[model samples]
Target chain A: MTTARAGALLDRLGRVGQFLWSGWAGLAGLALFAALWQAGHERYGDFILPAPLATLAAGLTIAADPAAWELAGQTTLRAVEGFALAAAAGAAGGLAAGYSAATMRLARPILTVLLGVPPIAWIVLAMIWFGSTDGTIITTVLVAATPVVFVGVAEGAVTRDRGLDDMARAFGAGPLARLTTLGLRHVAAFLFPALTVALGSAFKVAVMAELLANTGGIGGALAAARANLDVAEALAWVLIAVAGLIAVEYTLVHPIRSEFERWRNAARPWGVKR
Target chain B: MTRETTDAAPSLTLSGIGHAYLGRTVLDAVDLTLAAGEVAALVGPSGCGKSTLAHIAAGVVEPSRGRVARRYRRHGMVFQDPRLLPWATARANIAYPLRLLGLPRRERRERAEQAAQRVALDRADLDKFPIELSGGMRQRTAIARALAIDPDFVYFDEPFTALDVALKRRMQDLVIEAARGARFGALFITHDLMEAVRIAHRVVVMDAHGRGIAGTRAVPGKPGGRDDGTVYRLVAGFLSDDPLFRHIHDIDERRTP
Candidate 1:
């Protein structure tokens, strides 16, 4: 029993070690990329390109400023709100299209049109309606993200096991029960990937829309930095925004995705080791 | 033995049952009756409408032309594939049909455990996902799922085809034992005549064209005393001498020996 307890502890430690190794490898790759960027800046000079050290100093300066946090908060809020709205709408739409052939046919043309129109084009429309505000940023993010979620969920719905559905019917599972137990379970797998991609897209689109509309966010700070030709500060703000994106993706999106896919991951070769 | 209720009606009936797929005739004017507690096997050639007939009986596919009537309110099925939900645990898969019946969670779990025990599935394996299981284990889970609801009628479509000979025999025994209790009637489809004879009270042979039921033979006595030798002779006799059974077994003989 003591030996078995020791073995279990060793196994736990081994998993932690593997996780750390992978995390370090990823960090090393990012560091290497940054070093190359710094070398390129040294060759080109600071006006056109900023070194990693200069960018980091500028980032620290921005981090110290209360206004920078306020702008970051605005961008974060808009992106999240847009993403939440897009997820709800897309899931509802996807469920409808998945369950009903008529709804799918009717909605296909409209979704296609919406998906085909570029995020930038939507920003123009948003600007016309909401005009240089958070609403414009949110609308742009919504247009860019909803289709990813919709298509993900629709594909999931289409691929649902007819056998299970038949089993459910044989057992007299009501429509609502079927949807909750079988339908949602299948769709959950696709929904996470869709949400992850949409969330990332939401951040990028929200920031870009803010930059274009001159709204009060990190995008406006980027615009100001560009206007002043403060290349290091601009690069720093870009890095800060990217870091925020990674943070949100890791902390929010990944945890939810992992929770939904824990069973799936447990079946995978690598996932079994952990 | 409990006598079948005379007023209960037949568990299932197929009269003048005919089916075709994309202009190819599979079953023709097949007439079959399954009283409550009867276990019948539909056996024939690969292209014979055994599976198609099973599908028709299960209401997964509509018959091209025929009349099928069932007294049972609930029916369960096991396919050639395990067909358990990849996302769900073995217990959950077994409980799935019960969940549809709106059984409370406690009742569902209890029934699932009982069904798994009936199939000789280990209690430890209950929480394991389908992907975590071996092929035989998965098939056992499927059997457990089908039996979990204590279905009045069950349809099995070549369910043990993937199993090894030993595992196949074990599963056959489970089905035979389950049927003997009179809790369920089953329409079992298979190309293996020996398998049919081992478990079925009556075996129906379908025509190659799948147009209809061509022939049927009753295997006398309970399946418990029937050895493999008895099953082989029965299949061999049907293959060579029985005129009604001849066509279905001809192709299998050419392929096997």
Candidate 2:
């Protein structure tokens, strides 16, 4: 019993050590980039390039303002809402297209047309319909993100292990049970990566749409800062938005992704020892 | 006194079973019967539709113009490959059929444990997935799964062909022991005559053309735990000089020669 307890403690220590190592690496990379930015500022005047400290001070000022939180929250809400809709629609559509050749053939042309068009092209059309509202921003994100998710899910469905499906059928698994258990389990791996990409794209597209439409958000605040020739403030808002994106990715997406990836990580072939 | 049904009537029957793939006939007018409580081993050369026959019997394939009647309540099958779900552990794989039948979780796990014990699978291996298992263990897991449902009719399609000699013998003994309980009947398909004589009550040799049964031989002793020497001479002599057995055995020789 004592030995078992000791072993458990040792394992915990090892995990802690690994976590610290990764954290140190990330901090080191950030420090190196900041140093380079500071050096560039010293070489060039503040008019051309702001110092790293100046950027950080400007970012702190914006972060203290209540309006910045409201704008950040708006952009985040639109991005997440649009992403959820795209994920659901893409998965459903992809399943239908993947399972039936006829449906795939019918949907192929439509998917091609949507995927081919640039997100900028949809901006004007979205503005006309929604008149520069959050609806336009959400629509822009959906247009940019849905096809990426569709292709991932469709490939996942097409490449599903038929043997498992046959076994499930032989053992009398009903259609819904099979879909929930086997179909979704197989698609989860592909869907998660696609989701990460789509989530990232949603944030980018929503911000772009807000900026283009001159709506009230961080994007609009950025435009106002630029109009006032407050380059430091503009860059600071951009930094704050990026930091928010990183925070969301780490807290929301990364944890969920790692939960799903544990299985994959366990299956990976740890390199052969010499 | 109550009169029982005739034992002569086949428990399972296949009449004029023929299968063709793209105008090429693989099995032609094959008539076969499996008596209740009988263990029959079907042996023939490669591509003689041995596996195909097993598949047809297991209802995985539908013959072009044939009917298979089963007097048994349920049929369980083990293929040449173990065919266990790679993601599921050994215990879970064994309990798959029971899960399909909607048994409660406790009951399923209990039955799976019982089945694993019967097949001599160690307790430590129960939670290990297919990739973590040895080849013989995988096959043993497959056998346990087939037996977990207590199937009245079991079809084994070259199940031991991939195992090492010791593991193969152990598996063969397990099959024989299961068959001897009188709870199940089996249709064992293999190309090995010695294995056929060792385990089966009656051995039916299929002709090369897959037309009909070429020959039938009754094994002298009980189905399971028979001494190897008792049937060794008969099997060896038939395989060496008997013209009917000779035709199928010669095919293996010709390739190597």
Candidate 3:
């Protein structure tokens, strides 16, 4: 390669290095979290609280076990399925409710009642209705997560820039084009943050419902660990569930959210170009 | 310089236009005719229903009592503010009308680029969103958008009122060029008599109460080349000579006993 071409390659490598360094900085934050865990371990006895290293050892052993994979997969699948259904339902319902005042007035009270009932109450009902199956876990997750997503999407749609809508209308844009392009872009802004919270809620509600219903998952594994008084194993299962949540969030949801929000950077003086 | 000698009728005509809002009478029986290839500047006070008249002509708002006859193919509008899409780049905003017409993505991009070039937007600026551009650049993008579909007529609702003086004058030059070159009839609304005098083939004056069009005065020069001295002379003559134009400065003399 020519000297200039080689120099450009080096410049690209330097940018890659900078990006990796930023990720390493995030790892440093996890190290601080480890130190706090160590503090908690030192305060309590071995039976009550395990050391961070001990939990790591337990987590690794669980990761290697074939049965543990089945538990992990069930929990992840149910949580994901539940969250996806809620997101779709919420988005469509919210678009309708946000655009129409009559729908909003009717939905507001119904949504309020839905949000008021706890997931545990729903789990009891779900268990009685669907038995100790994946249905219980998934239903609980959906019930817990849907209301938050609906509120965010509804507010986003209602607060859209009417002027922009008028501009689009004057240009003769069809209804579908205007809704997808103009309406959805604004909704995504509110939807992403709500989805983050909802996803987290979905996992928590799923795990709780599984434990209560005694369906096979990380929650069942934790219950067994608790019966045997294995603090390290219980904590290990909790850590695995969280790691899955973070993995899905950072890899799937976050990238999509950032792609939609890329336009906002242009408004800033020092824009964050990818 | 000359009106269309072809057999085609006027591009737009407002016949006995009248409008009222929420039981308040704003405009009544205002008749105006804009021929093909002509620019009619509407000068009146802010509340003199100038914008209302423009809106009525553009079919943006239906008149309470008259008919608007549009003999043209496509009509475009430029508002006081740039009113650009915050998310779209300058080129995309310019190409928006075409997109609405269901053009393909590649064609839209090409047409948008061509439109951007018409308003003298640099290649770099065309890719920048509205918030990234200067106010003048934003307005230019708006104008580019207005002219993109090869409109037969355009409504200028005080489009340049938000720009700086120098930028406004530059924009006026662009408008004049577009007005003449495209042969599109325009209904230019403004409160500034100087702006109206600079580019209008005919200056339409409204009564002080904004109830009706009081008079119409034809400017001596063509749309693009009027000298400031001639504009000043005509403005002076309108204020001093015409009854409705004179009403702007007159303080009702029927006040005392």
Top model number, DockQ? 1
Q: Once superposed on the true structure, which residue ranges of model 3 sit more than 4 Å away at CA?
A: A1-21, A270-274, B1-8, B16-30, B62-65, B206-212, B246-257
Of models 1 and 3, which has the larger DockQ?
Answer: 1
- Put down candidate 1 lDDT per residue, A1-274, tens digits, no spaces: 4874697589567755665566776788899998899789989987889788888999999999998999999999999999999999899888888888898899899998998888889999999999888789888888899888988898889889987776665556667988898899999999989998999899889889989999979889999998998888988988899999888876677666665765676577864543
**Residues A176-271, candidate 3, lDDT per residue (tens digit)?**
988987899788899999999999999988888888899979888888888898888999999999999988887778767755665676675542
Q: How close is candidate 2 to the true structure, as a TM-score?
A: 0.84
Q: Compared with the true structure, what per-residue lDDT tens digits does model 3 show for residues B11-105? A: 88888999988877778888877888778888876677888888778766778998889888988889888888777778888988888887898
What is each predicted model's overall lDDT from 0 to 1?
A: 0.83, 0.81, 0.83
Docking class of 2: acceptable
Candidate 2 structure quality by residue, lDDT tens digits, A1-274:
4874697589557645654456676788889999999999999979877998999999998899998889989988998999999999988888888778798889889999998898998988899999979999989999888988988898888888775665555454677866776778778778888988999889888888888898878878888988899889888988888887778776677666655544344345654210
> Local error of candidate 2 at B1, Å?
32
Clashing pairs in model 2, backbone N/Cα/C closer than 3 A = none
Number of the candidate with higher TM-score, 2 or 3: 3
Q: Using TM-score as the measure, which candidate wins?
A: 3
Candidate 1 error regions (>4 Å): A1-22, A99-113, A270-274, B1-9, B16-29, B62-67, B181-183, B250-257
Q: What is the TM-score of each candidate against the true structure?
A: 0.87, 0.84, 0.88
